[model samples]
Target: MASGAEARDRLAQTAMYDRVESALNLVNERKSGLTVPNKWAFEARVGGSVSGAQLAITWSRRNEPEATLYLNNDVEPELAAKTLLDRTYGLIAASFADRIIGRDGARDVSASMLRRVANRLNELYTGRFDEIIHGQSLPLVSIDHLERAGPNPFLYHARTGEVLGDFTGLVRQALDRLIQRNRLRIEDVDVGLLASLFRELFSNTHLHARTDLEGALYRRSARGIVFALRPVDIPHDSFAAGLPVLKEYIESMEREAARPRVEFLEVSVFDSGPGLAARTLRSVVPADLPIEREYELVQKCFLKTYTSVSNPAHGWGLPRVMHALKSSGGFMRLRTGRLSLCKWFPPGMKDPRVTADDLQFMDIGGGSPKRHARVEGAVFTILIPVGLGN
Candidate 1:
């Protein structure tokens, strides 16, 4: 086995190299020339994928297309390049989105246009998550109880623009350390996935729902930061479908004891706000869909972007979460409406059978009546199976 020091070194090197490559890739794509004073200089800066994934970008402006350029002493050879690139892209996209939408509350643009901008930001930051850590070494550790928050056990911190961007890396690193310490073996865990979900939910709250509640979610405790995923009561059908999928997952695990044993899986997410219509509730989780497929829909929640936040330049968490859950044998269960939106999964998917009632009701639309829920707050519950894929 590699010594801890050796492992740490290798990991750091790999991450750095990745950052360098990402920076170079961005440069290769957009080779813009810059004029600084009269000392015309040219630079071909590069960033590794690690840096890019951390939302870092590097660039060199040249007096000429091919003039020799010198990196300033102020710049960290690696980070300066990546951060510059990432920041440039963010500003450009935000500016464009703002212009099209009319920063002064103009409704001149279509929703689709806004979505494109949001996806752009997601692409930019998704890769550069490491940039936020500033080369700090956080040894991997895994523990438990990262989930659960009284009635609502999830984190929600609504911040705007630069503040949001500043925290992006910090939040990602913090969650990374948290998951590392409480490593879940039965499922794949990633800070990007969790951060994306939390960010999206928080953005929605700030844009549409009640934004006054500061400590509502993502509360800092002596133990650490805590996010509460509350279970709101939504409409429900007498019939619940999708129990079979949970049953099958558990049964399959029991049959394959070699696989990591899962303690449980709990998913709590919302699409629409309260005061949902009866029709919306009845259709939340479809009745005809199989239990497993129904669960798949819940998993899809994270896949959705665009309207989660009013701004198109900033929605990506749900999709990231969806991708993360796909790898592990984990799944999500959701219920949306005035009754609530809830999801649950357990390790190995055994014993606890999803009853007919649990499998019958399917609310395909969450609380969204005609369009995206007018009330803009969402909640999610992410439960990882203990002792699995830590």
Candidate 2:
């Protein structure tokens, strides 16, 4: 009910997590110029988001040990023709002429600060992962950390994956590495389908975002995205807690591996576009719609008719992803805006892609979608058996 800016004084009096909660609500509001003040320093604390691009933008503005971005709109758009970044730049140019004037103003702020302030707001958004994460000092994957890691632990840059020229390059590298390291053969039916599945997800995250402020997707984006797949071993009791289908899938996988512990790769991809709520709000809600509608529309993304585009190929991306996971007995959790969905496939549920009749089979969790700490963009976490290649 209270706005992000309004929560400021209230936040000052509360404890740490309470302040974190307030910050999350501000970012979710989808308005630019949101500020969360405190005795904060630069750090990587997860959970944050924007209006339309749920995965990316949400992570960018995620309330961390540092401050949330305001006056920057590359990730979350608040208007037409210009992002909050462009508009904020214009306002700053007029109000604080000495500090910055239009594009040239970026030079005044540290690249790190500018990134949080205006992620991918400029032409040169791609660079080294070390600087993107820990600045120029520490190696992206610390050699010391590697020594302590288990045999299956993947060494990667958490703040940003391998720095690429663009999000497209990131997608290629992530998928390629997964296949190569796993020794997946092209002839395997699941291999090609797996590639297709991630390809569609990676490409769609880049494509689907349409900010009321900007017309083009790639043209306005400068910073790169990150995707990582790491190994995880689920405990038997926890497996039981998952959807009944997931428990069986894990059981079968362990039986095949013939090991006491089963390893699964946790795949994650993040993008900084306005969240689904903000994008749909542009078309669906003329007046104040229920905040819960954000969650409902996201679930509807699995249906055939719910698409943001007129193209014949637009709506099938997620369904295909689910189908591939089902083929491989995978499980997933998706978080964006006010929605979070978790689905487990036993390979027996009615096909979602072919028929809308089985929509109820989907498993989605519920909570306060507007809690200040949640992300503004989209973040996907999927668990698939590591031995998928064999």
Candidate 3:
């Protein structure tokens, strides 16, 4: 053994290196034998590493050893450091157990122990691991419970057990409320029409678009239907292909309205990707329309058939919305290319159908610049006008 001074210096250096080495090893050994309980190995990178005194551990989710007990903290005191590490492993085990055993899924002592670890972490480090250990939403049970009850008409996606009101039921309620609020006659309200519209929109999303994409159909009123579709993937096609049918649809809805008052039917669809292009806009909608109308038309584009992967038979989504507006003496709008348009018509107003020389098509001949066009996702919104009897 060395003298007092020499022993102190050697001891300090060894301990400091040992702590760092342990942290580094922990990082490398993340969850390496987690399934092997007796051989459980966890890695941690202690922050504020020192050569002599004071040890501070700062870790992030990235350096977490196992996929399960993923947590980081600034734990102090060397003895407490080991305890914190153990607590972390316990929390991971608990989370895993809560997922499987508590839910009646799987069973493994090690796995069970892992869950117990999570519980222990919650109990032991309640003050230190509030957000890190347990999230703000401490769910008593997993959402998967709802998923298990298949075909249960009353249950939804495993989380909200069978909605007392299903989508269709919600649509009916919305229609009833709208009718009463707007003083619309029972005969005047078209439940079948609304349902057809809602189902049609959902069908396009489910059958054609990405399977993971989600859609919601809601009846805003007796006269209005709202479709909230997400992750809309736009096809690279000319918008002109769908415009004729869209124009026709709008005209038809207008012709079917009760009074001369304006009614609106809107559909909104979006995606996780970027927005659409300017060149597409120039070729698709009538430029003379106002901002909101332009926005609506651009949004309505993807709802048309040629755009939908499913039934390519009748791509009348856009025209249906457009025609409905025309009948109500309202207008059509198209929003694309970081730009928007609103095209309106007065009562008894004739269709514009302006010549190529007109302001609507002044710059419509050639495609807009390509570099300016980024491959972005698309959002489709369709709004129809309806008339309510006073």
Candidate 4:
């Protein structure tokens, strides 16, 4: 492809994702019936085995040589899912492999088996997630979800993009499965509360995070949120070390139970955008301010009064999230800029004044005076104690 001085064409020219043109748009545009512009086209073919049942993807670029990148066959579902998942996230970073065109079983499986498949991919790409404070994707999509596929009480409520629906839809699907799986173990959950928690997080991303659309920078890109929810053993060495509250909670849980069985939900919500403060303060912050003061000001985002979005209805998102988690005794680690803020909302302590006070601050990657190695965008981890008091 050639770059022509950033011409803003009416149609954003990209490629076919599900592998070719004329395939079901992965990113459905809903009721208006307008054709969603796919940066890449994705199409899957049905064979003797079945169309929706077996999908293989061959990502192609216009004017460039074409190759069958991957195809999904029922015989090897995990491999098929792995192939597509690898391609999607990989291409996301692997130089413009966009567009998905399949409406077959591959779509169902990939979306359905998000946790099982994503966890597997995370292991393949990022090694075992159990050892880290941040698990890449959660609600753990895996091949198991596909193998034992059923109506697990999880449903796609809404979507944000043609590829993955909206951020809320993505979060709902993951949590639904997590809730479903936990039930088998006879553990009850507050489904409504969980849904609210995810919605608020999605609102943050929708409002604050700038999205990446095949290397194109836009005020808001419809790249649906990437998230996950997986069960984790409490008191992991790395986690306890970083989060002060984790150690205390573990000790309390153990003291109560003679034989403790502590399970924690590792929730991952990541957005590829500038730091919260930078994106929010793009216009608010003056160009020539000293870096430290600038950093301090950005930290004020959790407060309702310090909102960046002009909409009146939007300011309450983060504050509401904190209240929800606090009511449920949940904890979260928020990473942005050079600050890694961890704060657990205890069961009974209610802080009235908006959020910041609820978090403990740290510099994870490296810097001084509010600085270090910074994340390219924003990463948030919500830790919910499953079956603890519910």
Residues 1-390, model 3: lDDT tens digits: 332112111112123223433443342333221111111111111111110101011111212222222121223333332343233222222332212221111333345444444454334323232222221111111112112233222112335433222245534544454444443454643455544444444333222222212332211100111221111012211212223333443454445445444344344332211123222243333335454554444444534333432446546544454444344454333322334234444444466332222213111112221111111223234443434333
Q: Write model 4 residue lDDT over 1-72, tens digit each, in one string.
A: 213212111111232211211222211111111111222112110010011101111111211122112222
- The top-ranked prediction according to TM-score is 4
TM-scores of all predicted structures: 0.31, 0.51, 0.31, 0.52
lDDT of 1: 0.30
What's the lDDT for residue 130 in model 1?
Answer: 38
Ranked by TM-score from best down, the candidates are 4, 2, 3, 1
For model 2, what is the error of residue 244's alpha carbon versus the real structure, in angstroms, after optimal superposition? 13
Query: What shift in Å separates residue 167 of candidate 3 from its native position after superposition?
Result: 9.7
Runs off by more than 4 Å, candidate 3? 1-172, 190-193, 199-311, 328-377
TM-score of 2: 0.51
Candidate 1 off by > 4 Å: 1-163, 166-188, 211-252, 255-260, 263-310, 314-317, 339-378, 384-390
Better of 2 and 3 by lDDT: 2
Please tell me which model should have the higher TM-score, number 3 or number 4: 4
Reference-based TM-score, model 1: 0.31
Q: What is the alpha-carbon lDDT of model 4 when measured against the actual structure? A: 0.39
Q: What is the lDDT of residue 227 in candidate 4?
A: 38
